[model samples]
Target: MTWQTGLSGFLAGLLISIVTAPVGVSGAVFLLPVQLSVLHVPNPAVTPTNLLFNVVAGPGALARYRRNGQLTGPLARLLITGTVPGVVLGAIIRVFAIPGPQVFRLVAAAVLLPLGLWLCARALRPAAGDRPPLTRRTILGLGLATGTVGGVYGIGGGSILGPILAGRGTPMTHIAPAALASTFLTSIVGAATYAVLALTTDGDIAPHWILGLLCGIGGLIGGYLGARLQPRLPEKALRLLLGSLATALAALYLFQGLNPSGGN
Candidate 1:
């Protein structure tokens, strides 16, 4: 790759992680547009590439969270248990099915738009009396669903999980670390699944390793900085930010799905 392309990947990862890490997101979802548009990475391959980004980018914030004593928890474990298998399943479907982008984009938008609206609404409202605790089943279900989406989209599932958890009254401190940890692990599994499939399948299943690495290096620095900054921000602001990001992504997908020229 040219120096300019490498620099663009690095800068994109760095800037995006700095903004998203505070909310427990890996920012890979946001990077999808960059990969498709700016980097011109083709479909299918872009999914694994984003998963590779999470594998490389996730450790920075996770290390910081571990140092701060927020990394180990039941939530993270449950999420992993559900997401790992789900991601594997999703990867198989992605390679074998090769679902049309328009259909996927519309479905993704349908799921995200409501969640984003709900999160934003919840953030704006006064805190109601504490909600009932999340059942293990519910968490697992969420993990499975998000993991499948993550595998297909290569987002590591944190973007979906973080906002929903935050909206449910989970403390940002707990949610951020657990979500990042889950994302890191799931990405590893998802990437591995893709790599294994690449050996047998006919299409572009392998990731763009050099670009992924460059982006990951930048994310490593930026994620740590974002985690450091998170403690200082108010929970309300963080929730709002996550909701806005989700909403923006939903809009982007909706546009892509509806526009004849987009998401081919």
Candidate 2:
């Protein structure tokens, strides 16, 4: 990559990090397309590079959540249990699911659309005062589903998981941290999976690794600020922003899929 490319990626990462900071996500929703389209990174490098950012940016957010007492121990455990295996499987598929960028973009849009809408609805709806506790079984199911999507997209599934838990009546306060913890765990497995695949098949992924680290640096700062501001922000507004961002990204991916030539 040229110095210009690296600088652009860093700037983009910084902006995405700021946008995602209030939430527990690593900003892959914004970063991946830029890497693929603008930076012209290859398909093989996408997931791994995104995972690198997740690894770098995730810990600080998780730590903040833990410190704030927003992370639920048992819930996080349940989410990790289901997500780990699914993430592993998803990573393996990402390497082999070479139907071209068009197909992949479509698939990504399909997965993101529903998740975005769900988040939007939850944000707009009034918070229910009484809600059922999250059952282990329910968490397992959601985790597995979200993890699989994360594995394919290299997003760590916090975008989907955060809203689901919150909609189900898990306190918004806890949802952010729980999502962060879950994403952190799933990302470990997902990144490892991509690493193994890259080594066994594609040889070197050093460029992606380097870029991922750069992205992570931005994510770290953004995530820290977001965590710090969580208590002050209105829960509804937070959800709305996250959901809107997701929806916009989904649309962009869909547009790219339909007109690959226009992307970037």
What's every prediction's RMSD, in angstroms?
1.8, 2.2
Candidate 1 lowest-lDDT run of ten: 98-107
Residue-by-residue lDDT tens digits, candidate 2, 1-264:
687887777777777766665666557777888888787877757877887787888876777777777775677777788788878777777777643678778878887787778878988877667677778887888788888888888887765677677666777676667777777778877888777666677543323876778778777777776787777887677667877877888898899889979664
Best candidate, lDDT-wise?
A: 1
Per-residue CA lDDT of candidate 1, range 1-264, in tens? 789989999999998888778878777867877887788776678889989999899988888888899987798898888788888888887777755677667766765687668767877988887677689999899899988877887876655777677767788788888888888999999999999999998877899999988888888888988898888877677667767877887898899989959765
Clash count in backbone of candidate 1: 0
Strongest candidate by TM-score: 1
How much lDDT does each candidate structure score? 0.82, 0.75
User: Which pairs clash (backbone N, Cα, C closer than 3 Å) in model 2?
Assistant: none
